[model samples]
Target: MYDPAYGATDADLITFMGEEVREESAALGRRWFLVAELAGRRFPEMVGRQMYCADSISSVAAEISPVLNISHSRAVWQVETAITLRDRHPQVFKRLCRGLIDYRMVSMIVARTDNVADDVMVELDEAMAGRVEKWMKLSKNKLRDRIDLFIAEFDPAAVRVPPDADKHRYIDIDPGDTAGTAFVSGRLHAEDGAALDQRLDALADTVCSNDPRTKSQRRADACGPLARGEATLACQCGLDDCPARANRAAANAAVIHVLAEQGTIAGTSDKPGYLPGFGVLPAQSVRNLLPAAQTKPVTVPTADTAAQTGYRPNATLTEFLRWRDLTCRWPGCDKPVQRCDIDHTVPWPYGPTHPSNTKHYCRIHHITKTFNTGAGGFTDEQLPDGTIVLTAPTGHTYRSQAHGASMFPALRQPTGTVETTPLPPESPDRIAMMPRRRQTREQDRRERIATERRKRTEIITEQQRQHQAWLAATYEPPPF
Candidate 1:
């Protein structure tokens, strides 16, 4: 695989591959524009890896990127410029180029190319052409923003607002305001309201003072108490001699002092306005507390999934949630198993149930891994650092590095000067080619749109089936 004649490094491979693709395009009477799409699909692992490990375009080209072709054609000239300028302030260019590439692929994928109605297909092609024009002329940041705006515009089911209903109206209970009858039956004054606002503001200020402690820090803090409590419960004679117990005691004392300073409770009430242990209290009182009311809507999944998977008649939902969370205990990827089908490392039906017996990946990655099995999709192994080591299908093993360590490295500007060679002015031959180029681009854009329409039709059909399944399984149409 590393034969020098074929080009040894990743970059060499990319260049060679790109040349081959260009040749193929020419031989087949295809335009060079489709080469980008082919590159993205054929080398997704390489592309994805570079994106994960790169900081700037210059650094990526030097250390990771696998691109090969460069041109000054209308369709890909801007892209070529962005890539070639990798050595000159690369981060900005990399971001812009990647954004353009990502949206182009995503829009095509999400639009589903085959079945869109004729008029809709025409409109989509027009929109794609406009986006490409912006890409050709705009700065990287502007391009990124435009791509984001475009995605937002086409995202399905984005606005799910329900119709306004009488029951949805807000109810005001302020005693001074003309509203519903008060439950407390107390006289509300301006000062009292002001006082309440002040207290809430203070509480918010204290709670939101700094960023929340990360999961690791919180776990470390919890471990100290847990270890000490376990020791004490075990009645270990070492408890009296243990430094851990002493530290725990000192921490508790400090907590008590902080609680005393901060007001642990409000004034007690017989018929008093508020109860003692309410409102702005000491930090200790609320230290381990989660607010009873949460702002974010909780997605309580239906319990039917496990039942559908052929569980017992009376299975509790708690088990399903636990199983879902446990599917990928590999730190960052906590995808619910209900949404992901299981992948048996040893191949299920033949493999037994064990912790090491299975792993889970989403549909796309699962298929990709299967496709790249010869290259090295992923393998199960635990690293010395307690992180799981999964070999990618590309024959590269990526251990679960510190959550942040796997990210692309910082960008480095190119030290050498980039030669600025302006293109020669267009001749009559080049001018004559302009109309042909425009026509080719328009045709390619139309083809892509057509492809997207088909994909969308397939998706819509799938959605319809899912809807029907839902209706049949859980819903009963009213006496039709």
Candidate 2:
């Protein structure tokens, strides 16, 4: 038997992998085409329905979900994507069949351009078909920007804004694999999450430094006191004069930083505001925050004023970077600037403290960039317009542009030019100063699991004892 891959070179293998991806994309396009055809057959049955043909489409999706091994909602979404692509964006659908674009990108295109008028859709389809093939390497945010730019330019009314997530806030507690444990998760408004996080941090810090529990553990324990409306968490240290307990004060107020255009702050422009850790805020939501917010006018940096001689950026430059970078500049990393470190791309003194030479990187990635450099390590390069090009040890390169700049084009303006000297040679004996954990990850996990299980068991026992007492008190003989 012949095995073509037996003697394949790395380059050959890479090419083959890309070919496989293209084929998979083409197959998915064909599947969507068939789904659209099947759905078209049900159009007559869907006519003049109470919900404007929603029921018939739902029935089709319900029937397809089982056969496709997908959820009913997912099936319905796929059906909509298929119909939109087949009917409204036929040219783009043709490209999908040719493996020029994948289904995920197609789905995004369909969703963002969904509100385009029937006549306008034809033009958009033709325009997008000509451009989408070149967008293969774009990041998710950049891809959305590309799609949106066209939609905004062609049909401003058709541009789709993300739905207000606050309307769908919910919390869920699911039983864990261990009998007595549960996992808590939820979605909250940005302000609520910020306030809760601040309160938890404040409570967690009330315990003395001598407490045995890790910071994370203390934070988890703090939740109990917070729920009970307590002002402080009890210190675990045995010392009678525990300084943390003595110095504790009420939780500090949570301050949420939002960046918006002056027009947006007023009632004039509806441009959305950027919430540092969360995401984009609708214009109305931004205005709603103004009542509780301490408004400060931040100077947007220009090319001339972007550079400073000091190690740290000035407030103006910092604010500009926040608006420009929005999140950690690492490819595929979306940690917001609120939780990120301002990193010097070319390493400080050698490179001036300037926007062109700096970008946001979360602590982990900042350490990774600092420690991992030179041969067999990741390399980073930044462009004047806040684009970062990262090369991996594997030699694969990823280019990420400033996310905020895509949403607000003004942020794309280039900053001041800075002269940089070459980085000094690495020292052979210098050790990387990475943070070490007190406990191994496995030990920490085991401890957490044990604590949760014990707590849950205690809660169940208390509930059972109360139930028994109620039964004993209410017991009465039947009057038969």
Candidate 3:
């Protein structure tokens, strides 16, 4: 709170100024904690209005987004991270409050330890004691390295990555300050990077005689035509063993996995199409990704939907299960289905290869389930509609429902809790004729609002119906 006037030549001015900045940062952290506390405290008011937990949290996101001029996702992250900082690392939270460390330094610790076991976190808290200042002084990467060392020493599993870490890759499109464009960034495996480098470099040099764009700009420009299907993709480096060395048709290179309806794919409807791993893509993008998106004929099984005798599924069945689960069926893991082990809810041979009996799970969660299932740690039960409820060792159960925009967006989740009340016929209509006319903006907004509610409700209703039918058929009620 020191406001030094222009001519103040205090001997310790530099030190004092630095101290002020740190103090202010600590104050900011404390303020953020208060804000998150407010959100939790206000939850009841929103829920009392019959809003689902997800919607209530979205209220928090909406409130903070414009106030901070940040994206809703970023706003939600700030709130979630603050809550985790306090819940998982109270000592570090205190350090943040006292200005002993800045939020980013605390965030480094949070990232490394959030997914770790609770007991491991307690050990981490003990190990990190009295070192807050040291961590704060180090560069971010150095601090992360220190945290990694601690995780390795205390709980080696805490730093463990999936066996398929090489498959871990993603692209991020960051919107830049100057409008209409985004900075596309991504990480690829070494071989893939080398392949992409050759392809991009070749494209960049193609027009070198007249192109005045910078190398980075040229590469960026070159990616557009390839994605939009205007240009081809191939390894021009002539490297024999290069990953992209094999020639692929332009369409095949940009082929994306989508589960769009025949109507949506045919341009008859504009409902956003579902892309596995990625949620929904605009209709045009879906159409462009696979213009001739053919619908594979699905056999209408005479037997139960969940019934099959084989242990391993065939190609068609595999695709069905992948798109069916979308991600790992573990309570909160979102590992893409492509990277999961299709696991049986009921042990194999006993469970059968039916659709109902199996779900996808990442390796870690699959291992977790292997040990967790049966008599002790956890139990996985699949509902009639493929929603899974995990019964924990503590007896508290959690549900993981299949959700996507494909015909059934009924998997929308309400974080922290799942409200199972079916969404009523509250709207006269939820759709409008497209090219997305200007007249129905209000209706579109209303539909989006109802969507989250309806999805959760539908799943809940299905769960209730299945449970009720089971009880009626099997469990006999006493004369109480």
Candidate 4:
């Protein structure tokens, strides 16, 4: 192919290429919005014409693929997601349609807003308008952080409910057959998880002299023997004698220690309880774990008692706080509380050292709390329920919800086996075998519009015949 751009200067070529890429991304975003629009417009007309066997969205989508020369699945997905984004974040969607943001940015907006209530979504969408350029400069993770911050401030309801343990929990072991090893992973409730992580750390610290293995490598190597009940965590550093063996007593004391509300423990009412580092568990699970657990009761300070002690937390209070907060107080940061610095949200001695005023923050966020000031920096206010709503200098609010605060605990465990019923075989009429066609332009491929429409029409007519015959032979109207 002859190329006019081949003669251009390098700088011009780079500039032109970059501009085209951005515009093309914008064009595609607009095109998808149209796809959703087209489906809506053509659907009623198709219904009026009665060209479809059914009047549902699925039937409408089926016709769009053949008419436009696109895949039926792609058309449906684009329409559904586009419509959702439009409703949830109109401002961002408009910018995307105008080519101001790429599809990737659109996707990030969608992802971060997942599970957020619609009213909050609208608030977030309106909030993004003027600051999008600044957001563009951020890394994807940082952008996600910004979105999360917005959601927390605007819609704490989504963050308030921790992901259901039963739904999210799973265990997977990948066997590297030839490598003679397997990788195992799954979610554990916070309290159980902390114990496992602690044990791993203890074993990881047991290094022989001249250990060349990185901390991660040592941790990885330590898991096998710990699982197998072998205490020797020897490193491959070629040392004749290594002396960093951990105290078995501390490492072996890993156990679940849930802090159930005393009322729930006594069975008067089913108050949800917490497992530090894990999340809220039902009163039943709390009761289930308690009979086997070794209990050490620590008194949590009341505001009156806390204020009397010059606002300073005593050893008992500190221990209770560590147990209550298994990780950093920031919304999603999970730094273990044992290793975190206790920070007063309202910087002491101005703020009391009471449990209500104190929060656990990892070193990084601790500094962010101290130094982050002005409009862009973050500040927070704590609610009585332990929900902390943080506000950016920009005035957007975000929040960290208190975990283990379930209002209604599931006392009875869920019990059911997945039912696997076989679907009936597809009738010939329900199947469409597309005719082979020559390759076309990329845009045509995406749009599913091509010169093959006429030829494909013939294929559809023949399939309809087969479908009618099948209906004649097998259709059965359900008896009233």
Candidate 5:
């Protein structure tokens, strides 16, 4: 162990040892991606799979890899830095990189929807049925849920997904020639005037050319003529039958006229009536804001058809009920359609309405069902396998399962007790691998010297005092 001749100081020994360990750790990190891919499971699933592998040891980093994977595993260089000794200590660096790889893989599949192929969808009849075989096997529903969320966030408009063109983003109403054009004329305030003008410019540009920048980007760059001071407002598209132009214009005029007469600018318009000050309504919004008024049917009041019904005899009870359901049927939401509300798939207006459109929800999900802008506002459709498909406003769709994807199992009985799994223990090896305490060499030397001097001084002072006391006491005793 005495290696002075070799010039090996303790520092040298530690540095050499650290270098070796760091090299080995780096090498392991390099192979992590390949290891994750060969394992059919995603990066998150790898932690469980690796548990059974004899080569697998408990790693703090592996457990958190999914998060790190998305953040750090974007590029090779980033992965190296994330896992290298220069950044993280050798062992710790390796584990962190492992976690990153796992997360990266999971996020990719979820973001892309690697499952639910074109052929698979066609064979399954409806989109939701297709994902059943592919997605059901994953023990954790969180992964699938995350996949759906990712699709919702990143691809909500369903832009450029292959095989199904409808899955991609396209103009809702194609901008064609405006034959049956409608108009909304009124005084627009500063903010409203700016926004409307911007929209008009964007629409005009789109009409001129099919391609334009993104909506948000265009909005940001939009600087159009102000309409705050009274101005004529008219929108014309290339299409002769532009539903938005015709319907919205008609609705707006009716709404404005009514509001003007009443000397009030604000009111919800569900019917084809005019407000005094407000302009025409958008047709898409007409049913929710104002319902048409009609003469009540003559019917003898009966106990069954009580006042609670709010129905008049000879009244279109069917239409009235449809209107109620068409509103935010979710408890407590009164958001008009312009602000955005999910339409129930089943029509309540007609007899034996479709359940899909009847149960509408607004921006805030009611927490009863997964109501969202994704999957096209969460409509239910029967798949070929008789499974119900819940499509978000985004294009991604999933089947309602007997059991949920996470450890929080699906309800057995409505009254069953909910349980939560305990978190696992942390790895000691992982703890050991973190960067060591960073005391300075000078501070350490000073502390050691101070301690040594204090000990030596105490020894010397005790010896001197004892010698002096003994000399004085011995002479006195001899004399006596």
Candidate 6:
């Protein structure tokens, strides 16, 4: 059914690939147009709405999710891109439709200008559209820098600000596919990560050179003693008086949390135990953790214990909710429960602070609900069994059940019913009372961009001075 490319020369193949890419770009542009149309149809009155704000909610992504077989979050991003290109960057969209610019370039331009004000966006669109097609060979970082340069020149206040890296630092451990092993990973501050790497090397070297383990194996093993705060790793050469062995004071043990059934810990049952961030542990692995484990009994919530008269739940209730929900209760959100806030499904004053009326929401979603609830926003309801029903503004409902319910059936037990009073009429002017930054977004962006540009200028000036000094040191006058 297809012609073979085996006989084609390398040059012919290259030309064919280039043509295919152009055709694909044009097709993707048409697809984006359809996506924009779908979003419009779903929310015809979205003209004045802020589609990309934290408080904004859209069900168009949910509709697209099933059709595209992609995650809701990915679909949401696609919708945003489509709308941005079609409405905010008409000239860029035209270039895209003509296959002069690829989708990747379009995506980058869209993301870079996300915080741009409407008045500035029109100019950015026109400027970028005329130049981006010529940037097909630029590396990703180079392209990003170029886009930022344009933004900095046109509207310094609209340049995208870098996030605080420290706030986003994280560590993750995942169970390996192979039995009885786990993968450890993390992001750390540059100096800290480098120090850790050096420490691991030092610890690994403490073992005798004659030790049979490979360098990498020794380094991996060194992590255990390092985590326990040990100063040195014991030599394994089996010499009676090894020089590397030292009689040192014992360091404090590292603490970790592991959840398991009594039977599993006692070796009477083979049921796998759950490790919060890392997935299921084999029965043997659970038993292995018992040696250094400090067991904490998690009490199951009963009707009486689950209901709270005050706004805050007791520690017991809090623990129960964390174990039950496992992650943020917002549909498709996977933020761990440890990092989430226990929010009342129905506002506290109108409803009792009971398990049945509360669920986990990460900080972002918590604020999203706080500012975007009422006649034109999302609604949240909870069933007695810790199941949440979230209804979007477009009237599409998404259901999320407690993730831990499958592991612990007791979590599904109903808490006592609480009567909820009708909420007070929402003020039409409430939008005006929403929180505002001390400095406006534009002001903040401007300051950040100015600081960045100043630093770059300083660096360039220093480099030029260094170059002039080097040339002066090497100078020799020509003899007449």
Question: Of the pair 2 and 6, which is ahead by TM-score?
Answer: 6
**What is the descending lDDT order?**
6, 2, 3, 4, 1, 5
The regions of model 1 sitting more than 4 angstroms off are 1-338, 375-378, 382-387, 401-480
lDDT of 3 by residue, 100-126 (tens): 788678777877664456667776886
The TM-scores of all predictions, comma-separated, are: 0.25, 0.43, 0.46, 0.34, 0.19, 0.67
Q: What is the lDDT of residue 155 in candidate 6?
A: 67
What value does the lDDT take at residue 49 in candidate 5?
A: 24
Sorted by TM-score (best first), the order is 6, 3, 2, 4, 1, 5
Clashes of 6: 0
* Model 6 lDDT on a 0 to 1 scale: 0.76
Question: lDDT tens string, model 2, 196-261?
Answer: 999999888888789888888888878756765677877888788888777654554455577788
Candidate 5 yields a Cα-based lDDT of 0.33
Which regions of candidate 3 fall more than 4 Å away from where they truly are? 1-103, 107-221, 224-255, 290-306, 405-480
Could you say which candidate leads in TM-score?
A: 6
Count of residue pairs whose backbone atoms collide, per candidate: 22, 0, 0, 12, 62, 0
Q: Which ten residues in a row have the lowest lDDT in candidate 2?
A: 46-55
Q: What is the lDDT of residue 101 in candidate 5?
A: 22
lDDT of 2 at 67: 49
Question: Candidate 1's residue-wise lDDT over 274-381, tens digit each?
Answer: 111121232333332223212222122332222222222123333322232333323233333444444544333344222233344444334333333332233444
lDDT of 5 by residue, 1-480 (tens): 436579988888887776665465445455554444322233352242222211111122222222233211133233333322222133322343443223333333423432323233232223332233355245555545645554334333221123433334232322123321232334545576677766656443432222245555333333211222212222234456544344222222221212111111234322232221232333333333334322232222222331221112123323322232323432223333334343433322321222211233433332223312222134454322112355443344554321110111211112111122432433434323333224433345456545544554565578789999998888654464
lDDT of each: 0.34, 0.75, 0.61, 0.59, 0.33, 0.76
Clashing pairs in 6: none
